[model samples]
Target: MKTSESLLAELARSGKPIGVGVIGLGAHGSWAERSHLPALRAVPGYELTALSTSSKQSAERSGQVHGVSRTFGTAAELAACDEVHLVVVAVKVPHHRELVRTALNAGKSVLCEWPLGNGLAEAEDMARQAQSSAVPTAVGLQARSHPALAYARHLVADGYVGEVLSATVVGSGGAWGATVGPRDHYVLDAANGATLLTIPFGHALDGLASVLGEPEELRIRTASRRTSAVDSESGRHVPMTAEDQVVASGRLPGGAVACFHYRGGMSRGTNFRWEINGTEGDLVLTAPIGHPQLSPLALEGGRGTSTGLAPLTVPEHYVRVPELDPRADAPAYAVAHAYQQFLRDLREGTSAVPDFAHGAARHRSISAGADRLAEGGRIVGP
Candidate 1:
């Protein structure tokens, strides 16, 4: 009978729990298990009540593994459950639109993973649904929650680093080119699935856009494409449709041009680094410690001083919020935090970010980039 805010405050003060349902039971879903479930258990106001999977067996397995009270064979069943006030969709790109619509239409809040939809049309349609339904929706853009990046932005805005001149982000190391699972096998074919370009590249670019602002001109070039030794479920070498290595250049609104070099299959160490250049100084954004490559919603940066680049410490505030299971050292826990934030925004009446519009814009960028590649690397916008 308590109001949502009052309940949240009470939970924060007394360690109560919020009821939540999670959809999908794959690697990302398993992430929900290792990360979200524990974090939600640690948070003040959260509870894992239900989970849904395409197969009942998978749902049962997830339910047992995550310690959830119930398991539903389908997303709709989970959405309609009275015990579930929030739904977390960690499914594939293809199923996002339908599962999200189901949860929203069922009067449940939703937290969907990245790339809201596979294409612009799907993202636009999903956004329209979110708008019309008035249901709170959160997309996976956790990098915005990072603290080091936050400090960088603050320094930039405050002119600690003078007006931005230009920037470049290079994310290299490891071979994501090899097909990992049955669900992601489609990714090798650009036409069938969203590959590094749409998934990892999107995250990298989002980080870039977050610090630099929207780009005025964007151009993309893929060096080469070839099938790897990785075999798909179909027993054939999945055809690599998109370029595994891509170089995208863009001019920020302030006339600062940025270049991004991404190599999926490389021998270098697994590192994600970004740099921002200005008239006064330079800032190097490095992956934060404590959280894994994908988990740190917070980041770290190096600011140039008169002598050398000084370490800029940005507090990790995004994961600091109190939850039922307050365990650290796990990146998967972020998905739960991301989910809880989505529902918290809904219950608290704040604007949900990376909603339909954000997803649509990214989708547009993807489509536009593909078009440019087809047209021999011309500039385009989404």
Candidate 2:
């Protein structure tokens, strides 16, 4: 794991591309189909060599449609695939434990989609198995790898925004509200563990932390204002246990007070807005949609003597995957950056990839604060 060169050069030297096996890839429509598959295609050193679904027929159909020659009906079969160097687990939360452990036990590296497991214990178990396997692991927190966030962090560190004073973020949960499709019905139940607070807010938190560092103190308020959602398919209303609105305020590093608010579904007002103010100037990030992980964000800021906030174009060096147009699929673009980083880590033993340990840590942070928020907790210092 010490070789370092261009991806193609490294692949040429090894005489083979990095083989990736994807688990939980559905036959037709899925997040994996829309994001991971395209992300792998945009990346240079990896190929989708194998895929898995709930059944052999499904696996074959998915593999065939995606041009993957190998298909397996179960996680075990895919885990044992000799051609697979990395196992990408794209299944839902409840299934993350078994599939990730199976792949880790098989000695294959893994890239698990975010919220690594259904809960902290599950996430901890996955992280434990990963450590014992001694293989590279990555989580689905793509926001940490976004080029826009990277540029914003550089601006903060390079004195573009002198010692940060305060940061505020207001976001909307585009889908986890009013109603949901049959495929996404599971999210309405908090027990399913992929609610608005965990996925959208969790990713936004990741990006916020990456730019400002972890918070030292926090206050939170959360509520399930919309307790029911209509079933898009059945035309039935389902009771929801998960919170639809989240409000949090905290003191981050550099004594910056961070405030964040998110509500379920799209808002008539701004759907997404994150502002960082400092002694020198202020930076703002926005998008038409609320999910920063899935939507492209444009950066604008104003520094000393600047009349108004002007657009700041992200330069070329930070754009890791030029093949991915931010406008076309921002989520996939961010995902590709993480995938490319994992390939680099696999080659050079770097730690750029946010592994399951990071996943577990985030689970703890998100779950802990969310629990407190649900209880209407007040600000507390670490």
Candidate 3:
């Protein structure tokens, strides 16, 4: 088997845009259409060559709508296509394992969305497959690629905070509220693997880990405040088993305390706020709502005896991809940066972007924490 280095070198030497095939291109209001399509368009070195949907008719229709000629009804068909150099799994969480495996088995690179699998086992299995395939892989944890967050991470590392002491985060889920949409009802079921804990809280935690290091000795508590929600469109009641509130507190490396609290639904004030306090300084990140991976974030900091926090502008160099507004609230902004990083990794044979292995590690951490929570215990990290 060719090593990852050799495969990247081969792709670099080809001097052609990578042909990408995306699975589960729904008709409308799909993430693929909203974020992935626009992101792919914004970044160079990639071509949307093929796409697949649940049926041949829908696939052809989406192909025409997206201006792609090659469409398939099955992921296997798209993965086998000679024109497809990269296979993107953009479907629901439950379908990730099957589609990702199909692409990996066909010896194609893959870019799977976050919450990489239904749970830890599936994520580990996919990670093992990607390792054996020796191909480039990426998971959609775009919050780490956000320019503001990236700059904040650098600031923390550059001693702007002067030895981290503690961090606190509070955010709203934006879903799991008193009402559910027809398209989003699936997330209400804990079995569906898109619960508040796994989506909004999970993304925010990952972004926090990227900056403050992973939380250790974690104590977690979850509650479902709203047992049922009314369907906004149909006036029908839907049972919600997923936890609507999650709280976790722990210590980061270097003995800094970390605490997170996420609740279901939006708040009239302070929908998202994160503050990192240190011996000599403090940094704060905020957004209109939670899901830092999707929303734009603002950074503020005060260091060395400053009276109050002030907005800190991210330098232009942090916006690795040009021609895109980093401050836009659109989902495509951070996604475009992620795609640029992935392209750079492929060309330079670097693993800058989070891959399947990274996703699996995150899954393991979450799963372990959840298990301990179930046993009414705290998780002690390695």
Candidate 4:
């Protein structure tokens, strides 16, 4: 296996960029156009080659807007396109399986968004297929790829904080509380499998694990305070079955006590605050609102000799590419980091990129968290 260092040398030695085709580029104002488009254009070792949508007309429109001449009416066509080396699946969680399977069957690499599938079974099935296909794969899990997180991991390893004693995270769930639009109504139904717990909390947990090691076990308490949401598109009340709040406590793999609580909806209070206390010093990551993936995080640290925390800027060396926008907390900004890493991993044959196995690992943890929620906050081992 080539070390990441060797991969860097190899990439520097070769100048060709990886070709990517995005499935479900979405409509004019969707996340694909807003985030992925900008990100693909900004990253150095990537070239956007094709676009795919449900209809030929929509695909042509998106292709023209995005400057992708080769557009496909369906994912199967995109997957079989010779120009595309990597297939990016950004559609709804429910459609991930078929699209990803198509890409894999065509021997194309893929980068799928988080919650890899609608549920554990679906996620596992996808993971299993990805393994059998033997193609390089990546999950969105962009939070883990953030530069701030990269810096924190280095700091923790270097003992900026002597030994981690405990950590706590409190965050909000954005507009998932009481009101939602027709477009977002699907998320409110627990059966859809894209709920507050699965998306936001799951991403947050992965981010935490990226900085602090994964928790070996956890005990959880999950609840829903709102029984209904006003559908802004229909102007009617819709019954909601998804959870709006989750609280859990556990032990990190490194033996630090970890506590996490996520509340539904937007809040004026401390919307996102994560603190890690150590024997000698402490590190805190905070944001103005929830959705860590979309919120810029500021890192602060303090030691016993200091009266208060001080801003800690992430060193430029932690980032894979200096071309990436380090300022924005938006998806486009953060996701570029993972894209660069995926390209590097693809070129170098390294396992640094989070693949299907990694996604399945996270799914197991999430499934256990759900079980813990059901069983009255009891610890469950990995």
Candidate 5:
């Protein structure tokens, strides 16, 4: 196996594509088709060398669609293949720990979607494995990759927000978790319930921190206003072990107290907005909803009733985000970009954002909020 730096340098010098294998051909996997595969092809230094799925049908279908030559029935085969230099795990949450372990154990670079694991324990284990193996790894916290959020971070860091008074973020939508259909229905089940908080709020909260810096302490409340009725195909009422709605309060690392509201049970129009108030002025970002796939970005700041300005322009680090078919939003492309950066880091051996350790930290932050909320909203540190 090549060291990350050496691999990154080679990718830089070769000016060609890095061979990659994609594991898990479910909804996220399909995303790999529409987003990752195409983005890899377009990104200049990456290649989709192989594909894998648990069943032959999926492998065959995706292989035909993407023009992939080598296909594997399992991740182990994909990771062990000498033809692939990077392993992308877009599988279900329950399988993340194992698949990541397999790829790293095989001395291959790996990238897995967020929450790292279903809970804190799994995330910790994954972190430990990454540490022991010294393999380049990345998690799917894509919001930080956006230019709007980067501008927000710059403002906050520059004290333009003026000592960070408070921040409130609201993310509520019905169809937010898993899309209705045969596509990865397992995610809605309690066993697959990792998506509950981690999927929706995890991405949002990660963005929250990126804009506001780390949180010194936090408290969270999780409630199941409605139970998930199993889709007839799954044959069981997947207990909603995950919190359908969560509200959290905490202090930012800069000493700013913050309140957050997240709900996965919205049956009507969606509501996604975030506002931060500092001593001197306030900032509000609305629309573009929270999905990163949609590009451009709407920006508004400065005190007292100012309508948001369009094309406010963002930092260079903020990606313009490629367009996806379903037209999900910027978060979608932002996430894919994050994954691509991981691939770049692995192939080129450069340090990427939100590595396993960063992912583990975010997991701890959420876990801390959950635990504290259990105790009547007392502040707790992770």
Candidate 6:
């Protein structure tokens, strides 16, 4: 396999935008249309060249709506297209492995959504494939690219909070609550891999781990508070086998105590709140929603002589992409940043963007916690 440096250099020399072919463009109200499409258009050095859907009709319709001419009904055809240098898998988690494998076999770079696969084995399989292919790969753990969180990571690294002592995170899954929509009912099944534990909690955990590092010792508990959820459109009760509440506490590698609690549905008070305390001071991040990758986060800090926490404005340079409407709060803001960083990584031969391997590592961590919960035991490690 050729080195990524050579591949990226060749692509850069082509003097053309990275052609992106997206799979799984839903009929409407899909994440691809709302986030990926907008982010792709806003970011430089990339173009939405092609798209694929479940059927020819939907593919063509989405192509027309999105102003793309190339459309295919299957991921394999899209991946084989010469105009597509990057293949984006935006479908559900169960289909991620197949689509990503198709792209990898076609020798195209891939950007698959988070929870890289349905579970650890699938994630590891794809990660191994990506490594063997030696192609640039990125996973949609976009929360790490959020400007505020990125800046907060820097602050923590720079010792703004001094010696870290502890951290706490509380968030809401928002969708795994008492109600489910017709389109989202699939997430209620743990076998499908898109659950409260994976989607919202997984994204938030990735963001936190990016800043504070991973835990060394961990204990977890999960519960399905609501046995079933009412389908909002059809008014039918959907059996929900997925856990709605997840709690985990552990010690970070740096010796900081960490605690996390995520529950189904939005809370009346705090939807998302994370606090980091140290010997010198404290830092806090708050968001209106639990998905930090989709929602904007506010950062506040108090250090040294400061007695009260004050809003800490992220430096403008942290957001390298062109400004979108509503700025940091825009749905595509963090995604665009992720794309920008990926572009830089390609051009500069850097591996800053979290890749398939990183996704697999995160899956291992989540699986360990889940296994502990399943075994009804605590996990202690160095």
Score each candidate by Cα lDDT: 0.64, 0.83, 0.86, 0.80, 0.68, 0.86
Instruction: State candidate 1's TM-score.
Output: 0.80
All candidates in order of lDDT, best leading: 6, 3, 2, 4, 5, 1
**Tens digits of lDDT, candidate 1, 253-361:** 7788888777654434545567788877877765432122254433334444574676755545634554422235335444445545544654565653466667778
Candidate 5's displacement at residue 80, Å, is 1.6
Name the 10 consecutive residues with the lowest summed lDDT in model 6. 373-382
TM-scores, in order shown?
Answer: 0.80, 0.92, 0.94, 0.91, 0.83, 0.94
Query: Which structure is stronger by lDDT: 1 or 4?
Result: 4
Alpha-carbon lDDT of model 2: 0.83
Q: Tell me the tens digit of each residue's lDDT in model 3 across 14-94.
A: 766778899977668798988888888887778889999999999999988999999999999999998888899999999
Query: Could you tell me how far off, in angstroms, the CA of residue 67 lies in candidate 4 after the best superposition?
Result: 1.1
| lDDT of each residue in 157-216, candidate 6, tens digit only | 999999999999999887788788788989989999998888888898889888999886
**Clash counts for all predictions:** 20, 0, 0, 0, 18, 0
Where is model 3 more than 4 Å wrong at Cα? 1-9, 12-15, 327-329, 371-382
After superposition, which runs of candidate 4 have C-alpha atoms over 4 Å from their true positions? 1-13, 321-329, 372-382
Could you tell me which 10 consecutive residues in candidate 1 have the lowest summed lDDT? 373-382
| TM-score: the better of candidates 2 and 4 | 2
Misplaced by over 4 Å in model 6 are: 1-5, 12-15, 326-329, 371-382
Cα deviation at 20, candidate 3, in Å, is 0.9
Model 1, residue 300: what's the lDDT?
34
> Across residues 1-382, which tens digit of lDDT does each residue of candidate 2 receive?
4312243235534647788899987767798988898899998888888999999998888887888889999999998987877889998888999899888787777889988999888999899888877766889998878888999999998999888999999999866677777888788788988888788888898889988998766666677666677777898887777778888888898677998898887888989999999989999999887788878989999999986899999999999899999988776888998888776676675776688999999888876775433434322110
Model 5 Cα displacement at 306 (Å)?
5.4
